[model samples]
Structures are given as structure tokens and as C-alpha cells.
Target chain A: MNTAMLLLTYAVVLGAVAPAMLQRASWVERAPRLAMAAWRSLTVAVPGAALLAGLTMVVPASPLGAPLARALDACVMMMQDSYATPQRVLIIMVALLLSVAIITRVAYGVGVELGRAWWERRRHMAVLRMVARRDVRLDVLVVHHRAAIAYCLPGRGGSIVLSSSALSALGDRRLAAVLAHERAHLRGRHHLLTATARGLRRAFPLITLFATAEREIDRLAELAADDAAVHASDRLTVADALLTLADDHVLPGPALGTTPHDTGQRVRRLLKRTPPLHPVVTLVIALLAWTAMAAPLVAAAMPAVATIGVDCCPTR
Target chain B: MRGFGELEAAIMDVMWAAEAALPVREVLNRLRPDREPAFTTVQTVMDILYRKGWVDRRLEGRGYRYWATAGRDDYVAGLMSSALKSSPDRAAALARFVERMNPAEVEELRAALEAARTGEPPP
Candidate 1:
């Protein structure tokens, strides 16, 4: 129950549980990368928490410091006492749970506001207009000579924009690949996923797990989109389509390419012909992971069974 | 007049139709019988046209009066050249568009261009 004991227990608990949680939440193949990143972020944070716990052992003077210092001392004493009642321990746990809840609520509010701002700033006009021809009725806008540029703006009935220059730069096969890729985005509603992930990240800034999940999921979503493109056309055509656009200057925006996954990843994935998903394997692994997480809490409750039985008799 | 999706055709349409510096509104109205946009929209589109060196705009009244700088044949040729500058596949799109043109359509464009260039017919 002393500060060091409490700190060490917390560190051990967090270090063990965090990795397992990350492993379960992360993409099966990419779990190691997510775990390592999570570890690095946690490593910096855990030491500071341990230091705070260590400092809490020393009582201080001054009216402000007296109350807080005494509270810490009492908490330490309760934790250090081997025979401390389960009810007292439960009280401390409830306080910590409340703190986590408050922090989560604040984070979510921030994320929602930030997400709304991002959605507004990332403007994409659905109507495609060209500066050249007065005729040629078409639904999507096409700039005359500015081919090698294409992007899907997010919204209801969002149109895929392409410049005439882009149309000319890409051969038929490559053009088909580009259309298929953009279509995949439209069909799957990738923009909504990106927006949701961004909002979650803004809200839970401290929890790298949420942000990491969003980033990896975004990349995976793109990969899924690339798969759609491949299905629509040939894999090589999709790869070639990416290569053409890769060299071209990207449209100005934040959500465009901040994430690390790109054309190269898409092409490499296509070349390897990665299995999209194996349903049975995923289900089994998910079940086992959930069981592992639940086991410790169930076992921890066993020691208090006698106390619970005694409480039933009341004052004898 | 109406918003041009392609510059050459737009320029050709303007040149063939207008004898003087017609305002953007006049041009737009001449182009589309179905939907008439505001004067500002037409002017903005015309401004883009002027910037692209597709048409000539002269100061007239409070607004700028516009005229196409290229004749029908010249504009069509420009369109062909611009399409070629696009990807090789665009060359196919252009070729297909061109193949659909009748002899009379080709002759009319040539005649218009010749008339714009020379005041009189060939002797």
C-alpha cells in the first residue's frame, strides 16, 4: 500500500493489459507495429505517474497542501495494509473510475468540435465545371487541360472529378483503374470512416490506442478500396493508375495524404494478392482474446467471497 | 454566353454568331435557349475565356463586351490540338468525335474560317 508498491502494481498492470488490448484491437498482421507505438507513448507517461506516486508519500505544510498530502498519505496507508478491507479498496477504485470517465467525456467533446471544423474546411464542390467548352452536357465537372488530377469530394451523391489533362495522360487501362479506385471510395463511403476516426483522435488525444486504430483502419480501408479497384479492372492496371497519379501534384488539403499508407502500399498489396479476410480465423481469435481479458477480474473476486458471506449475517 | 466546357467550341460558337463586341449576357443568351443564367455568371465564365486567350473582351458600357478571337475552323483545329495534348486516349476520344462529323459540317467550319480571315470569297 506504500507509494512504490502502488506505483509498481499500476505499472505492471498497465504494461501487461495495454499490450494485450492493443494486440486484440489492432490489425492481426500489424499488431506488432501498433503495440510498439503504444509502448513508446506509454513508456514516457508511466514514469511520470510513478514519480507522482513516489512524491505523494511525503506530507507537506500549507493549508492547500495539507488536505491533498493527507489524502495521499491515507491512500498509501490503505494500499500498504495487507488486511485492508475490500470495501475501502473498492472506494478508491471507484474514484479512479470516475476520473477516467470525466477525462473520456471531455475528450469526446473536443473531438466532436474538431471533427466538425475539419469537415467544414475540407470543401469539395459536387458540380464539376470546366473553363473551356461551352457545350458537352455531363454530370461531373472536368477541367479542360488539367488532366493528371482527380479527387472525390465527400457528401451526398458526391462526384468524382477529373481534369481533361488527366484523361489524356492516362491510357484507357490506367483511366479505368483510376475510375474504379474513385468509385470504390464512393461505394464504400471511406470519407465517413476518415471523418469518424479523425473525430475520435481529437477527443481521445491521450489514448494513442484510439488514434492508432483510426490511422491503421484508414490505411486498411484504402487497401480495401484498392482491392475494389483491382476487381473492377486488372491489378496491373490499378497499379499503373496509381503510379501515374503518384507523380502528379496532389490537390491541396489536410486529409489528403497525412496518413502514411499510399500508392506504393496499394501496389505492393495488389502484387502480393493478400487474402482479403478469413472469417473463421478472425472469430476464433476474437473469442479467445475476450476470454483472456475476462479471466483475471473473475479470479480477483474470489478472495472477498468469505467477507461477502459474513456481511449477509449483519450485526450478530 | 453559356458556360463552355471546351474552349475551342465555345470560341467558335461566339465568333460564328457575333458580328460586334456583344456583352457576355448576349452571348450566353444566344448559346442556350433552355436556361439563362445571371449576367455575373456569364461574365465570370467570359472572364475565364478571356484569360485563356480564347476570346476578346472590350470595355463597353458598364460591363465588358466579348467576342471570340478564333473562327469556326480555327477553333475546331485548336480543339483538335488541345485534345492531342491530352493523353493518347483523349486522341481517341477526339478521333471518334471527328469521325462523326459530316462533310457539310467540315465544309461549313472551313467556310466560316475563310470568311473571318478574308472579307471576300476565293477568286
Candidate 2:
């Protein structure tokens, strides 16, 4: 019965509650970094909850309300029972399979994504080394292309790439702003975060929580990078640079360029200048995020403890 | 070190400028007529260049004759495009800049750029 309840909790969280909560959580845009943390925690928590639900059944029900050692003995006895009903054994097998499947899927997805990113970065580095001219003053690579595009390839030896057209198009101030924006992406390692989110989404495409988290995290990464860019260059300059490069499509790969999905919205955000979230509010949100992560573990553990207590000491 | 290392670039430059495909011996001869690199060294660098898809080689008599697959400008342009194409999944990568914006937004951007240029406050 407790196992059923735990499974139900996992289903409700992954299916209904998470999608609804994330949809309504519009304020996430105000504090993207915190929101990203919360979303990532929620993504991890769903699978964690499922694993916990499966583990609960492995622990045998204790009817005597006994001590920990006695309850553990009862669990072992239940496991060793040759006469154990086929139905119960089947349930245990299914639970074990489900937990293992979820874990394997997530791990495989992350590994594939990391490997692909690594490979793409290597190829891009080689290509950049061969073609791009280093501009020491701007600390960027200038590619002699007619199209106006600017982006940064992320990694240790990664570089900011700007097309010759982009250099000619933007004024000095806007150019600086664009440089700052690309620098922010590199400094923050936004590509890795986006790639991780992509991996999780690939692992659990059917789960609304992972899908929504992936999209939100991608958007918020851009917003957070914009915030960082604003520090070095004024709002208008950054906005102008965004507009100038607005038509340029980054070469499809691991490059994290300044071309956000919603340029108008980002531009408006820059104009309004929403202040950063207060430290206390950020702290509270962080605490809530941690609590959410811990909830599934506590939920899964409580039933096992209760079962142990019931078997160890019936009278109490 | 645009794409190729110094030695690789020298090889590529020689091949690109050559009127016809050059064997390793001829490439080495043209690269440095005075000191002259070893035949094997030129062969190795040319092989690396071939593997990297910068040049194509054909069997000419006993040895391989190599030629630049693309002009230097075209190669540089291709590199620029490839750098942009770094995303693992092209379909799901971030939206292109102009595709996301409408005509009205384009006008707004123009206004913003104009305002920035004139030092006028955004209206």
C-alpha cells in the first residue's frame, strides 16, 4: 500500500504538478539563475522519486512494530521465503526494472550528449585554428565572411568569432556590447547547461517536467547572459547589437551565439532594466529548491522506517 | 594558425598556388629550394592535410599528387560556416535571429540603433 502511494506521488509530480507549477511560475524570468536551479532540481527529483518508490517495496512490511535489527531480519526472511507469492515477487521485479531503466536512460542520455559536445568542440577548434584571424585588441577571431554573425565556441581553448560583415556593420560601442555578451556566455559556460538540459529532455521526452525545464533553462541562460553583458556595456548598445545580428543564423552546432529566440523581448527587458532579485528572496528560493530535492528521499524513507517500527515493537 | 599549422599552411599555400597537382618531392622542392625538407616530412604533412579534407590527392605514376580541394578564401568561409554549425542537433538548436523577429520588431530595432547613434533617449 505504501509502495502504491509512493508510485502515485512520483506520477503526480512528474505528470501533473510539475507542468502546472512551471507554467504558472512566470517570475522565473526575473531570477533566471535561481529558476534554472529550481527547474534542474525538479528534473532530478522526479526520477529520484521513482527510484525511491521502487526501493520501498524491497523493504518488507513489519507487523510486529519491532526494533531496527529485528525489522531488518524480517525483511531478510521475506526475501528468502521460497513460499513467497509469485505476485509479490513479480511486483519486486517490476519495481527493480523500472528503477534500473530510469537510471540507465538518464545516464546514457547525459553520456551521449557530453560525447557529442566534446566531439563538436574539437572539430570547431580545429576549423577555427585553420581559418580565423586573431584580433589581439578585441581578443576575438575575425572570420572574413560577408554575413553578419557573432558567436562564441565554448571550451578551454574556445574563441569568440565575428564575421567581417559584423565588424563593418556595428559601431564601436555596439561592437563592445556584442563582445561582452559573447564573453558572458563563455564565462558562464551556458552551452554546457543547455546541453545538460537537452540530455535530460532526450532521456524523458514524454515527461512534461523535463521538457518544460529544458525550454525554460535555455531561455533563462540567454537572459542571464544578457544580465552579464549589461555590466560592461549600456542597455541600448547591447540591444542595438542584438538587432544588428538579429538576422544571422549561427552555424548549427555547439556554438552559443548572442542570437536569442526572442530578440524583442530581450530588448524590452534591457530597456526596462529589471533589478536583480533581493538576496533574501534568492536565499529563500534556494532553500525551497533544496527542500524540493530532499522531499522524495524523505517520503521514500518514512514508509520503510514505519514498517520497521511496526515489526519491531507491536505494542508501541 | 588559422586552421592549419605553420607547416601545414606552407604545404597548402604551395599546393593552392600550383598549376597542377604536385608530388611530395616537387612540393618539397618548391617549399624550400635552399634547405629543402625531407620527402617523408612533406608527405606526412600532405597526408594530414588530406585527412583534414583540405586537399585531395590522386595517384600520379608511383607517388601521390596532391591539389587544394578549395581556394583559400572558400576554405576560410567554409570554416566560418562550420564554426556556426557547431550544434549537435541542428533542428532543436537556438532559433535564428531574424526568424524570431517580426517586421514591427525590425522597425523598432532600427529606431533603437538610430537612437543609440544620435545619443537621443529611446522613445
Question: Tens digit of lDDT per residue, candidate 2, span A149-241?
Answer: 777777777788887888888879878887777777788777777777778888887876777777777677777777666778777667777
Please give the lDDT score for candidate 1: 0.48
* Candidate 1, B10-122: lDDT as tens digits: 43365566888787667777756655556666677678768877678778779887777765445333443333233322311111111112234334444443443355333
Which 10 successive residues of model 2 chain A have the least lDDT summed?
A62-71
For candidate 1 chain B, which ten residues in a row score worst on lDDT? B91-100
> What docking grade does candidate 2 earn?
acceptable
TM-score of each: 0.47, 0.80
Residue-by-residue lDDT tens digits, candidate 1, A1-316: 2443454465456645664565466354323222333333443333333333333322212122343333555433533552266864564565445445545654574466445533432322201222333223433445554325655544563555566767777877777677676777667665555554455455556766445655555555556656667777866556556656544433322212332234445555454435533567555655554444443333333322322333222357
